[model samples]
Target: MSPASPTATSAIADGVTDDALKGLRRWNLGLTVLHAAQAVAILVLGNGFAIAVTSTFPEGPPGADAPAPSSLFEVSISVAIAVFLFLAAADHLVTATVGRGLYESDLRGGINRFRWAEYSISATIMIVLIGFYFGITDITAVVAVIGANVAMILFGWLQERVNPPGRTSTTMLPFWFGTVAGLAPWVAIVINLAGSDGAPGFVIGIFASLGLFFSTFAVNQWLQYRQVGPWKSYAFGEKTYLVLSLVAKSALAWQIFGGSLAG
Candidate 1:
C-alpha cells in the first residue's frame, strides 16, 4: 500500500498505546485463523449454491405453448462466501506476515486501505449474492446493485481521504456520507422483499444476519471516529471488527450450508 497521508496522527498518537499494540498483535493472528478456518470448512463440506434464472410468464394465447425457461448463469454460493472469508483473513494475515508498520499507518490514517481494497471486491460479491436471493436476475439490475455497493465502499475509502485522524470533527462529512451510500442496497432489497409473497426461512436468516452485521460494521467506524466510550481507542474498533468479521462470515456461511447444502 502507498504511504498514508501525513494527516493521520491524532488518533494514532492518542489511541494506540503499548497495550493496544499487544492487543492488535493478538487479534491479527486470531482473526486470520478464524476467517481461514471458516472458508475451509465451507469448501470441504458444502457442494455449492445452485442458482438458476427461470421466468414463469404470464398467461398467453391458449393456442400456443409457452416458451421454456433457460438458465442465464450459474454461481457457487460456496465460492462467494469463501471469497468474503478469505479476503478478511488475508487482511489480518498481512499484518502478521508483512509487519504491522503499514497496518499501524492505516490506523494512523483512520482507514485500513487493505480492508477497503478487499471489501470492495469481497463485500460486493456478498451483496450480489444477496441480490440473487432477492430474486433479482436482470443483468442491468444486478450490475446496478454491484455498482451501488462498490460506491458505498468507495465512500468508506473517501472517509479517510477527505478527513483523516488529524482533521477536525467538523470535517467528518465523509463518514456520514458513506453511511448513506451503504444503505442504498438495503433500501433496494427491502423494496424487493416488500413486493414478494415471502422468502424462505433460511433466506430471511441470511439477509437479517448479514444486514445486522454490516450495519454493526458501520457502527464500529462511527464510534471509533466519535471517540465514544471504548471506541476512543482505535484498537478497540480493530478488535470489534475482528470479532464482527468472524461472526458475520461464519453466520452467513453456515446459514447457507444448513439451508442448501445439507442434502
Candidate 2:
C-alpha cells in the first residue's frame, strides 16, 4: 500500500484544525453573549432599584425599614427589568445546552442539566426581586430567594468539579468558599427581612460577601495565569468568565451593597 502524500496529510490536518477552531469560536460567542446578558440584566435591575429609591424616599430616613416606593411608574419599570432578566437567563440556558453539547454524551448531559438548574435559579431570583418591587415582604419569598442563591453556588461548584475548565484539578475549595460567600448575603437578607434590628450588620455582611466573591475570581485568575503562562493558552470561555466576574459581579455587588450602605 502506498503511503499518503504530504499534501493530503497536511490538508487533512488543516481541516481538522479549522473545525476545532470553529467549535471554539462558537462556544466563545455563546459564553460572551450569556455573560453580557447577565451584566445587562444586573445593570437594569440596579437602575430600577435606584429609580424606586429616589422616587420614594428622596429626602432621608434610608434603611431597610424605609417605606416602599409608591410610584406606579417606578414599580412598572422594576417589573419590566425583572422580566427582561428572566428572559435573558432562559435564553442563556437554551444556548448553553446546545453550544456546550449538553446532550452529546452522558457527562455533557449532566453538566448541561446543572447549568439549566442554575439558569432556573437565576430566573427565580429575578421573580423574587420583582415581588420586592410589588412590596411583597413575605418571609417565604425572601427565604426562597436565599435558597436559590445557595443552590446556584452549589451548582457552580458541581459544574467545576465535574468539568474543570481547561486543565484544572478538582477540589472542594471553590464549593466551600462559594457556599460561605454566597450564603453571607442570604443570611443578611434573611435577618433584615425577618424584622430584626440588624440592618448595619446585614449591610456589612452583604458588602463583605460581594467582596469575597469578587476576590475569589481575582485569585482564581491569578492562579490560572501563574500556571498557564498567558491568556492565549486559556480555554474558550475563560475570557467571558473573567469579564463576567468583574463586570456582572461587581455591578451587582456595588449596586446592592453600595445602595444599602448609602441608605
Candidate 3:
C-alpha cells in the first residue's frame, strides 16, 4: 500500500471543481436562452395581435370632434420589449463566450455585468411606469403600479449590492422584501383588471398570465431562501433570481403599457 502524492490529490480536486464550473456555465446559458425566447414571444404574440386588432378600427373623421388616434402606449411597449431582448441576447452571448473553461474570475465578472444591466433596465422600467401612471387617471391603479415598480427597483439594487448568496448574515430582510416586491406587480395587474371597463379578452388574458408568473416567482424566491428542494447551490439560486427578475420586469412592462393602450 502507498499514499497518494500531494500533486495527484490536488489534480483530483481541481478536476471536480472544473466539472462543477462547467455545469454551472451550461445552466446559465440555458437560462439565458429561455429569457431571450420569452422576450421574442411577447413581442411577436402581443404586438402582432395588437397591431392586427388596431388595424380593424376605421380611421377617425378629420373634424376636430373626432378623437385623435393614440399608439403611444403600444409603441412604448414595443420599444421596451425590443430593448430587453437586445440586452438579454447580447449579455448571454458574452456569457457563453466568457463562461468557457470555467474560470471563476471571468464567470463572476460576467455575472456582475449582467446584474448591473438588470439594475439599469429595472430603473428604466420604473421610469416608464411612472410616465404611464401619470397618463392614466385611475388613482388606485396608479398607486399600485408605482408601488410595485418602486419595490422591484429597490429589490434589484439590494440584491446586486448585498450578494445574498455569498453572505453569512441573516437574509430575512431581503427575503421578505423580495417576496413582497415580486408579488407587487401581480397585485397591481389585478387591481387594474378589476377596475377596467370592457377590457378586451386577450388583454385580460395577458394580465392573468402575468399575474401567474409573478405569483410563482414570489414563491420561488421564498423557496430559494429556505433552501428547500433544488435551491441549495449558490449557482442555482442566482440563476433562478436572474431569470425571475427578467421575466417579472418584462412582463410587468408589457402589462402596464398594454393596459394603458387598452384604456
lDDT of 3: 0.50
Candidate 1 on 92-129: residue-level lDDT in tens?
A: 88976685788776666566677778778878888877
Best by lDDT: 1
Q: Which stretches of candidate 2 lie over 4 Å from their true place?
A: 1-51, 54-89, 92-110, 113-170, 196-263
Sort order, TM-score high to low: 1, 3, 2
* lDDT for 37 (candidate 1): 93
The CA lDDT at 33 in model 2 is 68
Clashes of each: 0, 0, 0
Residue 66 lDDT in model 1? 60
Question: For each candidate, C-alpha RMSD in Å?
Answer: 4.7, 15.6, 11.2
- The per-model lDDT (C-alpha) reads 0.76, 0.42, 0.50
Q: In model 3, which range of ten residues has the least summed lDDT?
A: 1-10
Distance from true location, Cα of 234 in model 1, Å = 1.3
TM-score versus the correct structure, for each prediction: 0.85, 0.31, 0.55
Quote the lDDT for 124 in model 3: 43
lDDT string for model 2 (1-263, tens) is 11222211111211123344445446545654655565565555444343232234445655546565454333333343434344544444454456445322222211223334543455345434433433344454456555655564564545444433333233455455555645544454455556644445544444445445544544553443344344323342243343543344334434443453232
